[model samples]
Target chain A: MAFVEARDLTKHFVIRRGWFARPTVVRALTGVNLEIERRETLGVVGESGCGKSTLGRCLIRLIEPTSGQVLFDGEDVLALHGEELRSLRRRMQIVFQNPFSSLNPRMTVRDIVAEPLKAHTNMRGSELTARVIELLRQVGLNESHLYRYPREFSGGQAQRIAVARALALNPDFIVLDEPTSALDVSVQATVVNLLEELQAELGLTYLFISHDLSVVQHISNRIAVMYLGEIVEMGNAEEIFHSPMHPYTQALLSATPMVDPETRRERIILEGSVPNPANPPSGCHFHTRCPAAMAFCADEKPPLREINGRLVACHLHE
Target chain B: MTEPLLRIEDLYVRFRTDEGTIRAVNGVNLEIMPGEMFGLVGESGCGKSVTGLSILKLVPHPGRITRGKIWFRGENLLEKPESAMREIRGRHIAMIFQDPMSSLNPVFTVGHQITRVIRRHHHVSRREAWERAAGTLDDLGIPDPERVMRSYPYELSGGMQQRVMIAIALSCGAELLIADEPTTALDVTIQAQILELLNALRIRRGVSILMITHDLGVVAETCDRVAVLYAGRVVESGPTDAVLQAPAHPYTQGLLNALPRPSARRKSLQAIPGSVPGGIEEIPGCPFHPRCALADDLCRSKTPIMTPVDSSGAHLAACHLIGKSEG
Candidate 1:
């Protein structure tokens, strides 16, 4: 069985205008379904406001999903509440995109890494310091960094500290939301390699969310392309990248600049911008900008279906 | 190259802080030919944006141009008065910031914002400026420009806001544009459209461009020539193809290797070790020597200046290894 499965997960935020006014609902995630295998990294790639981050929060119950099931090791996560849910948070940790803002400024590196240990377990004083140092070492830091504050570290080093904190509880599944996006290119590689090494050492599963296609392509085993609030296509990394069936996926891939000058890519520039997510299109959300959109695409919303070991939701696939 | 549209000679920028004067752009010399798209690629704090800002005289407060001159079309821009520089800023030279949403005013309608630029540059009446703004918006592939003009910036998507930004930047008939990571905040599909629009405008109007970004791939695809910056200095510069294919400086090579190329899946990225040094005086040797694999005693003691290499003639590298190997 897959380690984590999100079946028909949905979240809608309701905005109340006033005491007398009617409430308006903003649908962030619309019946999203995904299955993450054990010891595998599943990358969720999308533009801003595409609800990828919302989906991540939903899976981890950081923000409770309005409806549907988040099955973790064959148990319903949303069903758990109070201490049960709190304890489950130990099993699943999250590393936010901005390391500088995520960490506490006043606290030393030791306290930041040991906060989880203090909350979840009963270890403190010198033992806590030792454990924090060990966690730091695991994430490629040294003993001398124990007393340093977050301001003393660079962007890459700050992210390493964040990773060390995430690994404090020895999480089996970690939700990395654009973990390396804020770091420089050369430094991004170090963090990514550290994550890969940690995964191998501890048998961790990851849900990597990012807008950067290059980094996503490098780290992911399986990839899902999200548009608006829906997944347009998903499959094994190689298949999705090499032979993308969806026109949206193809256009997105072709638009990306290949580092090699010899490979002259035919960049398909899609005109117009993404539509407003609060007031999405009625039929197919992507039909407005999709180059290969058909008449039926304007009338009916396609359901996600399996075709050739890939899950795609588009008229062309149908 | 027709007097080289923009010539930057020995430009240096420094910021006076509590610690000391931090040298940002150190003796940078660059020449952008007329109607050519030049790229400045570097990581953050490498002085790419500072160079772009120097053209517009928009460097942040306290960050002053310590030395050097900027010649635009045979005229000295640095010597021009602030009042004259104001006239030059949006009229002849335009700039597009990385974040379009923040750059745009929240209260003003998209149409009014665009027309404001047109009115400032040209002597057109309000009605004509508004009309021209709408026309440019339409030309930028924004469907139903009339409705979009009336809408507020918050109502539009990031891609739409960026398109509006481009429309404003191009509406003034600016001869030169400095785009600092204009498409970094956008998605690939939207980024492609923005790049295409810029290229189209450049070709049609014969406008000179200076694109500042950290992605070398962007340089390869869009730029005719590229300058690789490291720690506020141009480590290497040449024709885009020549530099990307075989980088001369170790920093440039490390950056190229760090990129995840589409052609290879199994090849591991050779990441440069250590982060950029903080403070200008924190490091004594070459700024990149701490991270460079081939750093030696000579590299540690002296800073290497730009020297020509290969047959490109345009290709120049600043490195001890390149200097010694070539000699």
Candidate 2:
């Protein structure tokens, strides 16, 4: 069994339009099935509104999935409750997307990192302070930052603080949701390296969710491509990035601008924006914008089938 | 070589904060040739955007272009009066910001906003302005420009909104377009489309572009010439291909090597050792020495001036170790 596995996970956000209006369902995740090995990073890549974030939340049980099974070490995450649930949360934590909003502006850095330790453990006073300071140093911050608020720190430093807070409990698994996307390139480089170091030292597993393919490629062992809440392709990071099977993945990789200026890549610019999740296409969700979509693609939803040691959902493959 | 279209000489911008004076742009120098796309790229607080803003005298108050010579079209713009600056701003030079939604007016119709920009610069009637605005939209590859013109900013998608912003920027028949991270908020596909549009505009209309971005990939793909900024100074300036192929400055090399390349797999990124120093505190040596691995005693004492790295003399890098490292 994988260290973490999600089976047919789906999340539908139903918003009520006025008191009398019928509720509309925004299908954020339509049946995501993926797995992460022990001590490995799984990258989920997709454009906006693709439910990659929802999948990240589901794996760590940050939010309840509409219908799915998230197995952590072959144990069902959805079944735990009370003390067991509280304890289980310590093993899995999440880092959010935006640094400015994730950390509380009112609280000092010490209090913020110590919050998780206080809630989950009996550590108090000097002991808690020592642990918080240690955590801060682990993330490349020092003693001076302990009394400072989130606003006082730069974007990269704030994100490091957030990472420190996530690592306070020494969680085995963490869902990093666009942790470095909000930062600049050079600072992002620092954060990326920090994550790698922490992962190595702590033997941590990560569900690294990001829209930036390049950043994801650097950290991920295996990569999964999502489109409109469905897992379009999943394979080795190098394989998926170098030669993607799914058309959506291909388009994404093509659009990813490489730093080398000499080679002018032949990019297939997709025609339109992502389809409205609430009113998705009839069959295959990607058929609306897929280039190699067959005539029957509009009517038949493709199943994720195994091919060449990788799983891909497309009509051409199966 | 052809005469440069826009030349920014020894620009310096500073902010008066309560803590102290923040040196934003410190002795920066760059030249943009006519009909060429030049990229000014760096991380936050690196003064890439401030340099772009200084070109248009758009640096916000509290933040002032303290010293600079902005030469555009064979004239020094720094010496020009505010009235002359205003006359040059929208008519000859226009700008597009990062976010499309915030940049575009929310209450106004897209057509009305675009036509207003046209009317602001050109002596055209409302009908003529509207026609020209729609025509500009059409040129931007928007289908049914009339229908789009009638819609409000909120009605359009983000990609469409960006196209509208581009429409307005180019509406006044501007020759130079200053795009400050124009596609940062956009999706990759939308960004590719917008980049293509910008490239198309450049090819067709011969518009000079001053594109500022943090992503080196964007610069690699679109820019003809590139300037690498660090700590409010130009560390390197060269042809895009030459600079990207072999970045001389340790900072530029670190940035390129650290940037996650899709083609390469790495055990760990070569992160720069230290963070950018807070504000320009009059560092005696190279501003990047604290973070640079190859900094020597000379590099720590005296600032390195831009020296030609190639026979062309166009590829320049400000690094004392460039010779030592290359050896």
What TM-score would every model get versus the actual structure? 0.96, 0.97
Docking class of 2: medium
DockQ for every model comes to 0.63, 0.71
Cα lDDT for residue B103, candidate 2: 89
Q: Candidate 2, B303: how far from true, in Å?
A: 1.5
Q: What residue pairs clash in candidate 1, if any at all? A: none
- After superposition, the stretches of candidate 2 with alpha carbons farther than 4 Å from their true spots are A261-264, B262-264, B324-327
lDDT of 2 at A23: 99
Model 2: how far residue B25 lies from native, Å: 1.1
Candidate 1 lDDT tens digits, B16-65: 88888778888889988878999999998899999999988888978999
Off by over 4 Å in 1: A19-21, A262-264, B262-268, B282-285, B323-327
Global lDDT of each candidate: 0.88, 0.90
Query: Candidate 1: lDDT of A279?
Result: 82
Chain B of candidate 1 versus the native chain B: what TM-score? 0.95
**lDDT of prediction 2:** 0.90
> Least lDDT summed over 10 consecutive residues: which range in candidate 1 chain B?
B260-269
